[model samples]
Target: MIETIVFDVGETITRDDRYWASWADWLGAPRHSLSALVGAVVARGQDNAEALRLLRPGIDIDAEYQAREAAGRGEALDEADLYADVRPALTALRELGVRVIIAGNQTSRAGELLRDLDLPADLVVTSGEWHVAKPQPQFFERVREVARAAPSATVYVGDHPANDIFPAKAAGLRTAHIRRGPWGHLWADDPEVAAAADWRIDSLFQLASIAKG
Candidate 1:
């Protein structure tokens, strides 16, 4: 039985993949290429701050950099609304006896976002909090520790293949790739993504059926 479900806040829970577009414009790289680049950076053990520094000049990394700064200072910015139906989906999952945990690189931004949505999650595992992001095995390992979960009984639902899918698979957790928000195109084109994910759902609501199995 699945006792815990790990979720990625941005894109997966919140409709905020717009950061990718900002990233692309800031880095002057193609949006898709930036997706792969961020994956490669994480794979190489580089921090997001260092990655931003290495990126070319004239790119406005301000929004992202500012958000991180705000998080560090414990300030909340109203970027936009968290994804619609996120509260309902989370409430439904909890009703099914599934403890929901957030696993992402978001600093305190995710927690603030969830709070703003008025939805309560059981646990939040963040790279900023843990000093690592997904696709790196340590991210899931840290999450498992925080959630007190056994890998086989937990499922990670996220949108990124390199970070979300591959690492969760390696961590012995089932992976559900939800493609609809930002990185929707990345999910469509990433070759390694399909093989890494155990299940693909277009929406969070679909997890109810998949988890039941």
Candidate 2:
């Protein structure tokens, strides 16, 4: 019996493409034509500095989003706010008696986003709070500790293989990789993660079905 469902906010439960599109639009770039250089910067382990030089350019990435929100042009700039149709799935999970938790590299903005969407989560474990990123086993171990999740009773659902699947696997948790997204590494694609995943799904709606069995 799966007791807890851990979610990766960006591409797993939320629609990250729309958020990327918003960023491209804010930068005055064609949404489709904007070079996916963000991926390269992330792969190369460059801080937001390189990404700013190429994409944001003299704009404070965080401040710009806040400004947009202040000007009423943005609702919530955080992943929890920008992603779509997540609350419903979370509600469904709760209805099905699954304890839901969020694990991501987000600021405290996650709490506001969840409150805005009115989603019910037992806890949210973020990278900022943990001081570690995924693909590092310590991250998952910390989340497991907070959620008190048994290895056999919990699963991690995320879009990236390294950040989402690898660390979770190393931490002895089952993993579900969400397909179809612009995650940093093409190597994190679902087919690749599926080769090692205990389960796989294209969307959060499919999670309950996958977990029930």
What's each prediction's TM-score?
0.71, 0.74
List the candidate 2 regions with Cα displacement exceeding 4 Å: 25-28, 35-53, 56-85, 184-192
Q: Encode model 1's per-residue lDDT on 1-213: one tens digit a residue.
A: 777888887678766445655656644677776666555665564544444555564545557568546656333324364666676777888889888887787875555655565555887556776777666777878877766668877888887676677778988887888876545444544667778777788878887776677
Model 1: runs farther than 4 Å from truth? 17-80, 189-191
lDDT value for candidate 1?
A: 0.69
- Best of the candidates, TM-score: 2
lDDT of each residue in 1-213, candidate 2, tens digit only: 888889887766565556666667777787764446666665664542365467656777678868777876663544444445577778788888888998886656554564455457877656766778776777888878865768878988887776788778888888887764655235454465667678766667887776576
Q: Estimate every model's Cα lDDT from 0 to 1.
A: 0.69, 0.69
Clashes by residue pair, model 2:
none
